[model samples]
Target: MPTTAAESQFDELGSLYEDVVDWPFRRDIELPAVLHSLGDLTRSDVLDFGCGAGLYTRLLAGQGARRVVGYDESEGMLREARHREAKEQRGIEYVSQLTPALAHRFDVVLSVYVLPYVASRDGLRQMCASMARMLRPGGRLLALPLHPDYDPHSDYYTAYGFRLVSESPHVEGSPVRLELRVRGVEADVTAYYWSRGALEEALHGAGFGPVFWAAPWPPGLARIEDAPTVQRAYLRRPHAAMLDCRLARAAE
Candidate 1:
């Protein structure tokens, strides 16, 4: 993977990266949505793209995945992941990039909060193609990227410890920079934007079928009338969007 400004930013984050994504919104809402989309993992071969700190990779291993390999471009992030793997002995494999030998080897390829780091449409297309190649026939790709409808200016929920310093017009392929504060440390992060149409086209071009958008709130949310006010508010304006896709059965 080519080095980008975002990759360098993540490298600097390193071990501190875990704290940035440890908010309740991720644990209570985003993770559940991802797991729901994943359905079952028993004996499945899984690939975690951009698997920072091996958080989800370890989780998938715990869920009975037969084989789990995590790939990330940032060495600093991988260092943290390696540290945890050595300590926990979860049998997870971490690599910097996918090699050609591993093509079509995974039953499921999951990426979370990674697509926005792609700085160009061509980069996103290549990413989709690589993800497609990673999956076997009928394999699924579950991705969670920043929502196209996200309003950097909104104050609906501000407890996540980040603020938008500046934003470009919400046009396709624009850039958005954010100022993040975690554990009394501050940093600037940059991410690119993709309209729904742009993302759909990239997926389809890479041999993925129609993309399905999953709701932020799970089905069981309807039964919980006593849900916390913050939870309900977060659901109303989710910062992230779930994209569920699958490799075509006839894909080469």
Candidate 2:
């Protein structure tokens, strides 16, 4: 069995999960913010941890990353990625294992929206350790975890094409149900929420420090037809957050 159970939740999702990116919040804000945080990808070796249909894999390669690896445990999701690669022929590698040759290999590990799937502290630690191992010392890990401060009222983000139904009196490990109704694509998913302290501990335990969470910055309103209102509401308490940190050296 895998160390974490997240893959199970997404196994049947296949390519459907990839379509969520078209939602206004992700397209106008989340995607741009993350790509900007990466600075430049020119010839960078990147690992798309929990790649999920190679969305970032394709984007990273398009951004000039020399090589990109899409790693995920869901065979169904990998099937979708592989199928796309067969047609798109992007030269990206999709794998289910974190092999020895992959250790300390990537310059950046883009773990978009993966943290919320961890079911336990140990799973979170394992996920972080795996990400750290894939990253060279001083390489960056750009993780987009479900926002720790997401409005518990659930419907607070209806305008963003999704709603979060959190457990009442939620705490670390509580289930946060995610309902997606974006661009005519609908799906129901369950994710876990970890407190900020627990998240910090997991990252620290995995040899990542000085973690910085970024606020959602919508690059522009060009895409969203109704920008001002959605921007104000979503940015006020976004459903997901960006985290930037580096694998610390042994001495540091």
Give the top-scoring candidate (lDDT).
Answer: 2
Worst 10 residues of 2 by lDDT: 218-227
Task: Give the number of colliding residue pairs in candidate 2.
Answer: 0
Writing each residue's lDDT as its tens digit, candidate 1 over 116-233 gives 8888888888888888888999899988877888765734446666664335746787877766766788887888888899899889998999899965766467733556665776
Any residue pairs clashing in model 1, and if so which?
A: none
Candidate 1, residue 168: lDDT: 70
lDDT of each: 0.80, 0.83
Q: Which stretches of candidate 2 lie over 4 Å from their true place?
A: 183-185, 220-227, 250-252
Q: What RMSD, rounded to one decimal, does every model reach?
A: 2.0, 2.9
Best by TM-score: 1
- TM per candidate comes to 0.92, 0.92
